[model samples]
Target: MKGFFSLPGERLFHVATLSALGFLLLFFVGIISSLATYTDWRQFFSILFSKEILFAIRLTLFTSTMATIISMVFAVPAAYAISKTNFRGKNIVDTILDLPIVISPIALGAALFVFFNTSLGRALEGNLMRFVFEVPGIVLAQFTIISALAVRLLKATFDSINPRYERVGRTLGYTKIKVFFKVTLPLARNGLIAASILTWARAVGEFGATVTVAGAMKMKTETLPIAIFLNLAQAEVERAIAVVFVLVAIAVIALVILRRFTSRRQTS
Candidate 1:
């Protein structure tokens, strides 16, 4: 991926851009360092090991995983369809799908909150299940926020794949479904994994909508992000810092896993 334009002062441009990148890294590192400096190691460990924090950690993992799975189920097919098929109003549909990704999660959460008050929402709550301010609402909120992101990523993956493989399978009498399962999916393994990782990471950090839809109930709806927010609200800065460290740790682990997976795939 070359730059769009070659600059007359190309060497100077490269030096300036590299300096900018270095500065960005330093800025973030300083932020993380401040988190560490805010509290003692023992206090951080104590806060992290507390029952409430443990529960929040567990809830965060479970909800994010559920959201990621649900997102992938719908996203894969939607992305595949959008990438492989040309249909009427596709552009319209595509744009509509992108709304969830572009819209503020807080607004999305608020909308979901409002939806549960409507007749349909009330009926679903009465007959099917409850969502608003519930644990399930956390999952729903996460799904609403990250599903479109998953679609965007998987669509790009599908777009990059050569359709020739599927065509070749069809020539040998494979049904479209068969070709997809056997041929296309294998090629999309890397993309599927990458999208899942990103979606799950986003879901884990989701706050505005989850807080809006689930409410900030300690021990119940308190995900890691919610715990952080709750602590910060009560001026429990040390506790909040601990949770921030946990989030940073999760992010670092995710990045390392992604990097390793991508490297191995490339090498293999």
Candidate 2:
């Protein structure tokens, strides 16, 4: 023990470990205190059972799921193109695809608001494109933010794969589309699922863009994050904490599932 402690790197290792443990302790203490105060165990248990919260949660889940699916549909092809094919202005397209990650969500929402409040919005008002200030707007906002991330992740995953696999498939007379679906996609399935899960989790918790585009209408556009914000603004501390706890729980479950799937994929 003395020899181990006397090592040159031991001091740094001890400091890092202590700092990590201290942060973990602070985190658990906060969680416990929040759960203990302003919240009865019974209420916490029953919060998800409430009709209004249940409705909001259902709407949130539905919208996020739809947005994630749509985002993945677009992301896969875009990522494949960026990773596998040569095209003019590819760098510009890649930068634009990833530009959302740098912009403020509130700013993005405000831009959407401005665009929708103009003649373009009027033209889209009665059409299928009336996405700004509706439930679809919420989906669109989530899609805008999460799809960029998905594209980044998918592009990385696609690049990590060797193009030679596809070439070999082609030599066997398989069409390009079939080669992709049968080979590339399956090989990248784990990464794709990881990306989708991450995107869904982000979508579920998005507030700024959603509120800007969807207007936080109760039982309509009131996602979990918006519920937290609305409750906080309304001075409903207990309800806000409850909603936050729900979001935390959801994020944890999603992370666990992602890890499990990723591990299984690696082992198989």
After superposition, the stretches of candidate 1 with alpha carbons farther than 4 Å from their true spots are 1-8, 264-268
Question: Which tens-of-lDDT digit does each residue in 1-99 have in candidate 2?
Answer: 657767677998989999999999999878857665777667776776777678778888999999999999999998999999999999999899878
Candidates' C-alpha lDDT:
0.92, 0.86
lDDT of 1 by residue, 72-154 (tens): 99999999999999999999999999999889999999999999999999999999888887899999999999999999999
Can you tell me which runs of candidate 2 are displaced by over 4 Å? 1-6, 17-25, 28-35
lDDT, residue 129, candidate 1: 82
